[model samples]
Target: MTTHLRPTDLRYLRLVRASAWYDLVVTAGFATPWTYALLHDALSALGRAWGLGTLPPLDPIQTLYANLMGSVVVVWAVLRLARPLPLHGLLDGTARALFTGWQAYALTQGAPRFLWLFLAVEATFAVLQLAPWYSPFRRPAVRE
Candidate 1:
């Protein structure tokens, strides 16, 4: 498979893996209660440090949802990191775009200013992953 791949394909694969690594690093803490506790503490401390007040502690259900999101994203990231292809980039881009939309909506509903950071990162990855398709000089991606 490597022998048949072009240079552009290699670059695309690298991009996909990079995105996956980002996901893993950003979301891995959400996957378990202990990690989420640490993450929540750190975030709250950061919020206080930034002069933004902390919110109420997360309830069990909310924690469950966070855990679910973290677990799923981490697993998906691992899969892409281990076996990235152009298709993975396209799909991950689509997912990130959706995430960006939802995250924006959450902000509009007054979730938190902290979410802006995540939203920005998601939007960046979404564009990077999807932009090749819209480039005028884009080559057709090799089929998986």
Candidate 2:
């Protein structure tokens, strides 16, 4: 496949790459056992201080599932960053939109205030991945 990337496409790709890196770090924090506990404890303390309800501890099964998902996201991000395909941006953007929407809704249902910060990051990355797709002047996709 030959990608005739315009300047905007290059910019979008860069944004995606950065977002991938950010996700890698954030996901790692969740997937790692020690860091996960630390983060949970910290948030719980903060919530208690702020008079919000404390975060619940994750069960073993939930931890396993979260780690598996984190591993998959890492692999997908690496592959997409290495190739920068239009489909990558499309799929990632769509997934991010759904995930962000779900997260925002969950936040409304009594999640921690800090979750909003993560939501903002996800929404920004989703826009970066989607804007080029909806641009009037985008080059057509050509599959070989």
Candidate 3:
């Protein structure tokens, strides 16, 4: 039996490909240093603000976690690029959930100013991942 390609499927593939490229760039180029710096400052500030003493000097554990997370993102992106069709919905859904959670956390933290940068990045990623380009790749219920 032959399977026919639907417009939605095509769109989904496009989304997956785009998202894969984005992830690769962000993980390797943007997020690595950016997260390290942000985490360092945020943790230091939180420690100082609460008088909990200064954060311990950055250590191997911190580096390991950052590297692991970054590697995971890179691997996932590579997989999406290799198998765009099957991974499209999953990637988009994951991005949406992650961003939504981040938004909620930012709101609850009551540090809107600091969180805005993260919120903006997450929002942009969410929009790009869930755009009509990927709608075709979604399951029937989610497709428009």
Candidate 4:
């Protein structure tokens, strides 16, 4: 693949960084047990306010998994924020696809209606990052 980045590549890089920033901001708060508790409660309250069912009470295992996911995603987000590249966008989009899939699966399992919001965002980003227009192969080859 071509490493000769183009203007369009720069635009895609921005999208990658932007998505990473979003993930960092949103998931950072879940990296700890205490923060996860707060987030859970806040989400639960928001669900009620919106007429959606409340989330289940936070348990130790749930907290542990949440913290793990948050920590990993936060670290990955920081990587893209600091050194974003087209490849990063492709990989992040791949991860977002997986996330969207799992989120949809959860909903099908009767998780919550509020989850649709997250799924929408995930799927949108995934589509944008993975869009065929950004494929390096489609760009005019750079003459060395």
Candidate 5:
């Protein structure tokens, strides 16, 4: 079946793909590394404060979590690039939910300094993802 997308839809798709790439680069360059370091430092500090002789090395589990999350984000980005309008809504919703979760976790953790950076990234992604759905930029569906 042939498919078509309106200009608005096409714009949104490009924005979504760009946003996802932005996320991947930013996370790999800053977010993930800084977070890993911060968590490692925090855990080590906690151990020191508790008078433990030696702190364990950074938790592999935590590193795995970050890697998995990053992988998922990359996958999402690739999907957006490959299948733009067809799955736009789903990706947008997913990004929103993930951002909301990050926000909640950040707040619960008393707003760690790094979280603000993460929030900024997440917010950008959310805005780009949701732009097409907004009243001013909504796109009409295609017909066969």
Candidate 6:
């Protein structure tokens, strides 16, 4: 079957696909043991600077699992973004939004203040990913 995508849809696909590279970099950083330590150290310093005291140690198994999950997300996003599909952004955006919301709640309840920075970044990207769907100027829906 042939598909005729609007210009905006094509633009969105390109944007999201390009973003997958950034996600891969970030996911790998968090997934790799050595790189994760760097992130942990930076987060510890941020916490100390914010007067939150030393950060707790990460459980190795949990961290590894979390990294694996992130890696999976990266792969999923890459696959979804590879095509000029209109709704693919929904999955990535929703995932980020939900995760960010949970982290925001946790931060308020006692997660390190430093996590706020990460949450901010996540929220920003989530908005960007989801915005096209909600845009007033978006072209008519793609017919499958």
Q: What's the TM-score of each model vs. the native?
A: 0.86, 0.75, 0.53, 0.88, 0.59, 0.69
Candidate 3: clashing pairs of residues: 8-136
Model 5 residue runs over 4 Å out of place are 1-8, 28-57, 134-144
Query: Where is the poorest 10-residue window by lDDT in model 1?
Result: 1-10
lDDT scores of the candidates, listed in order: 0.84, 0.74, 0.62, 0.87, 0.60, 0.70
Ranked by lDDT, the better of candidates 1 and 2 is 1
lDDT of 3 by residue, 82-107 (tens): 87764465566567668668667856
Candidate 5 or 2, higher TM-score: 2
Q: Which stretches of model 1 miss by more than 4 angstroms?
A: 1-8, 135-137, 140-144
Write one digit per residue (lDDT tens) for candidate 5, span 1-144.
Answer: 423333355555676667666756655432365666675576557555765432346567767776667667666666666776636644665666687787878667654344455577677666656555555665456599
Per-residue accuracy of model 6 over 1-144 as CA lDDT, tens digit each: 433333355666775676666677667667667777777777788789888755578779857866786768667766865663556666777788998999889887888777777688778768777876664634566599
lDDT of 2 by residue, 101-120 (tens): 98899888988777777799
Best by lDDT: 4
User: Candidate 6: how large is its RMSD?
Assistant: 5.5
lDDT of 4 by residue, 14-105 (tens): 99899998999999989999999999999999999998778888889999999999999999999999999888888998999999999999
Count of residue pairs whose backbone atoms collide, per candidate = 0, 0, 1, 0, 0, 0
* Segments of candidate 3 deviating more than 4 angstroms: 1-7, 29-57, 103-115, 127-144
Q: What is candidate 1's lDDT per residue for 42-126, written digit by digit as tens?
A: 8888877886656559789878998999999999999998899888888999999999999999888866578788899999988
**In what order do the candidates fall by TM-score, top score first?**
4, 1, 2, 6, 5, 3
Cα misplacement distance, residue 77 of candidate 5 (Å): 1.6
Rank order by lDDT, top first? 4, 1, 2, 6, 3, 5
Which regions of candidate 4 deviate over 4 angstroms?
1-8, 133-137, 142-144
lDDT of the structure predicted as candidate 4: 0.87
